[model samples]
Target: MRRPLLPPTLALVFALWPSTGCHLLLDGEPAAGIGAPCEQDSQCQAAQCIDEVCASPCSTSAECPAPATCTMAGLCQLPLRAAFVHVGDPATEQWTQAHEIGRQAAHEALPYLQTEIATNKLLASDAASAIDDFVARGFPVIIATSPTLRDVAALKSAEHPGVKFLTCGARSSATSNNIAYSGRMYQAAYLAGFAAARRSATDRLGMVASLPTPSVVRYINAFTTGARRASPAALVEVRWIGFWHDTLPPDAQGKTRERVLTEALLASGCDVIAHQADNGIPVATVAAASLTAKAIGNNVEDACRDDATSCLGATYFRWGPLYTQLLDGIHRSRWPAATLVELGMTLNPAHSTVNFTLNAGSGSSELAIEISNLLQELAAEGGETVPFLGPLCSTGQRDLDADGTPDCLDPGQAPDPQELQRMCWFVEGLVEKQDPADPTSEDRPALVPTTGDCAR
Candidate 1:
């Protein structure tokens, strides 16, 4: 993580220095005032087109507008410095890796954009210094890729009104200068579950899950719901590893907990395994243990790239376009405050936010065919092939309506966005675990959904 290198006074001086670039004007008329569209210096009133914008010449930071710094080129420019903070090593963790890809893509799309990253910011406290350091270094935009940093992002946004901040996976309402954004990944999860079930001969699907976070639970529920849709007899057994990264200590057998749990699931007749964990350990474990068993990847495309033969595609998020759009809005200063931007297949015209990928070697099995078909259906514009429709029930069989039944939803009904974000219950097809320590345990127990697990 980055540390504060310059004192407050010196930092402020550097922040206002030539580390930023100008933003474009809205008008297209030639020789328009600063902030108007321009091609060359002749088209701008200020006689400069710096950073693809009509820019006012400035000798010092004092002559520039607030948050716009005087560049070395003697032009007033908005701070184009942006930083991305990740929870783990992006090289090893698929979730963080996705954001890194986004950051690169954004930079490539906007060459004037300056970007940096701080890794291993797993907590708010860990991320706070990194964010402050970036701010002090003249980064006017901070993109935290983990939900754990949302509170700190909120605090910092209020402290630095000139700086824009964004946090991932946060359902909270955005405030001035800070917005919480997330992708609707459950849609892809449903398709992955359906594929897993279709590929399974025993109709037994296993999931190595991390924390029972609302988002994770929603993914699990959607996965199970999809599996049941494909094969009514399908039962998804979950093994909670308790940590998003699953860096738990290895057992006496010299195996990581994720590997042990994955092997156990395979041993218990689970022909296909899926994971909601941060890393691709489940896919790796399955690839090494069973020749026939397949695993589903999460968060990144080609997650099973290392073990494609043992993999059954993946549900991944492509953050490039979304990041590009958000950064572009910030660059143009058109972003609205206190707004929540939830991108998904239906919302984004490209349908690229939440996506699925199938291995080319998956062959012509029923699973592969169905996955291809579902992908086509989902890719269609304004399609209604959603996964979380009605006729569903919770794991505990709790009554959602007063009709004296355990059904959570009636036929043809769909869960709202808020409900999906705050989902805390699993679907009816989730097999209850007998013992928390035993990943393969099948003994039934009374399970209930509560709000505690929904807290981020």
Candidate 2:
């Protein structure tokens, strides 16, 4: 079992230098400027365009790191501040990337911010208490991650409206100082699907997901949708482990189950596989499998040392730019509690919040290079890369409009913001359909003895 954190860890007191780039921002959001569409990834100032937006990379500091500020023009360079506090540890792959590494990356860009990194038990009350402690200590910007903290975060934000609070995986009312935002991973996931599909020998692809929520739903749908678009006849298979960051039980069982799922997929003839869960067990599984197959990682950009050089890279983020944006908003224009910001990817190399990386070694192959180039083109601005929209089918039960009737989307239609955020259905093109009534169909629980589990 992981040991409890004894004290607040002040990870570092580093200075930040702004990322060098020119960007266009509208009310602090990335916008395409009058510049000609970028011809390649490196041509852009902000290393973004992962979403095909031919604009400056970031709209705010959350996209870049601290000490680095994102200007209204979408540049991440003016010096910036505390004011930031991150709660969570690196014990689990998901938490590590989301909190540990996320903090470091954000700070690297926003160097002026005096940030605090704290870890508590995997419980909401504990998280809330930690935030309370930080609030007492005068940390005005509190970035609280973890499902356990979602509800309490809303309450705490209300209790201390003077404080800037942020939450993930859930929404806060639009009337408070608290705001919620999520990574638009589906955009990158679609690219991964397309890459995996192109490399498949059997046209069978397997994916291991974290949970059944809309985020995971979007990831799965985008992936399969992209795979099908590329391979045409490829089959996308999926499995789940029943929770997010299952660090309870403190045993290898959770990990073992994750691997078994991969083995089962491979055994069933999947030649290319992807894993989108938090702990990144799939990286190890896909890397270690004796069978030769293409593997993809999600969420974290860095290669796993345990499986160095084995992965095709991963879909990653730079929360510093985005977080930096939130801080600026709070200091300048106070946000009502329930603000929502949905950021997509751009093709800037250093500043893209979302990026697709392939192993340098594997990328040398003609096919690997081909996949890499294809991703670049697809992610390039002004391309036909809407993997989640139109001519779709639903793999899970869905009620997009919430009318008395539920329906699968037909051709010429797409899942809207509500549908995507709610993520009640999967896009068409799975190897097999699943029961909407299945317990594992939606929401997973945590491993520890928590008061609530997303457990279906």
Candidate 3:
């Protein structure tokens, strides 16, 4: 329920700046480069002409002109000196990839921002130490992108009241001077669901989630709901891989839960699948090779160089606007202490919401357009109410528990955050097991609405 804190005075300043002119710098310095125009690499000393601008060579501290340092990529980049830490399981290349999008955007939007990536192993000691290291480094804004990092962020926010924290897939009530939470991801996930529904061949789908946390739950529910609305015949199976990290050893029961569940769903005739396998490349490749099924791409798909026919399309999360907006706030010296920012489908031409990559040699432009239109309509409805709600039932026969009234309607009476965090049961029509030995089980129940509830 976090709201935007945009003051009228600050809004006016934002209105005046050219749409693309909001860049954050330490002392009003330009982000790209300094000095007069140049045409070639050798036009200026220690500077290369990139895109017609004279910029310094980048590789390391020595490569940079002054004050700037070299990063892990061997690029001479502006040193924000402010540590932007993203904590998640790097093993799941997908989550890592999604966060990388935000990191790249932040780096480009605010030239002074430095970043660090950490993996959460669920060990309390490791989590505590990670927070300590970030604070010790004097990182101003620490972005926790995973559920496991939520408690860590909260604990650290209390200890270091001067540092600012932002979480992506999780939320917390830690409204300390140094901590703020935002859940704009529901918008992204909803869009992803829309994309999945469009590409489904059987109108039967599946979702593999990392954990039952609020962030993941909301995404799963929203996706299934969206799919049902778009294609009532579409059945979405929801599964949980209890662990966020994708590379965990199979539970001692000798059953790789995620793999087993996924195989089961494929055996049961699901054509399209979307899962929170942070490292979706492997899963996508496997699904493509194993089940003759199609995969809905996410962050990693943008950088995919492979010829994956199963990759029908992907849902991309563009964090550039948010970063640019925050940087603008900081530069104008009017940054709000505690604010919630939501970036969805807007008039900004730079934002990329859902990207549909057609199968090679398949003329599917018409289909893609149809899908895009549906997504836009759903997005227009906003996040307060998901597309799937009425007459809902899970395969488990868990009553579509509404007290004779839909849970989404009736303002201020929505499901509590705690309920969302603990969501485990799948909606009706899915064919996944409730208990699986593998912590990363992919088996899930398909979600469908009751007759007369979903749009035809």
Model 1, residue pairs in steric clash:
25-35, 25-36, 31-43, 174-338
Order by TM-score, highest first = 1, 2, 3
Per-model TM against the reference: 0.81, 0.70, 0.66
Q: Ten consecutive residues with minimal summed lDDT in candidate 1?
A: 8-17
Best candidate, TM-score-wise? 1
Q: Per-residue lDDT for 236 in model 2?
A: 78
Which model, 1 or 2, shows the larger lDDT? 1
Candidate 1 deviant stretches above 4 angstroms: 1-79, 346-351, 365-369, 376-385, 397-407, 436-452
The lDDT of model 2 is 0.58
* lDDT per residue as tens, model 1, 1-456: 123221221111111112222443445533235544345667666447654466677788788655556766566665577899998998888999988987887777654367889999987788999999998998878998987777788888888877878889765644666778777687788888888887899998898877767888878887888898889999887777777855757778788878877987887788999897888888999999988999999888879899999998888888877787677656644564445666555433233678776677774666666776776765454333557777876765444554666557788887776666666666787875677566556646224334345542
Model 2, span 339-454: residue lDDT tens: 56545555553544456666556444765666556566556543324466555656445554567464766676776656566664555556442442342332221111112322
Among these predicted structures, which one has the highest lDDT?
1
What is the Cα-based lDDT of residue 176 in candidate 3? Answer: 45
Error of 3 at 396 (Å): 8.5
Candidate 3 segments whose C-alpha is farther than 4 A from its true place: 1-80, 88-92, 116-122, 178-201, 250-256, 285-291, 301-307, 336-339, 347-349, 352-363, 379-385, 389-456
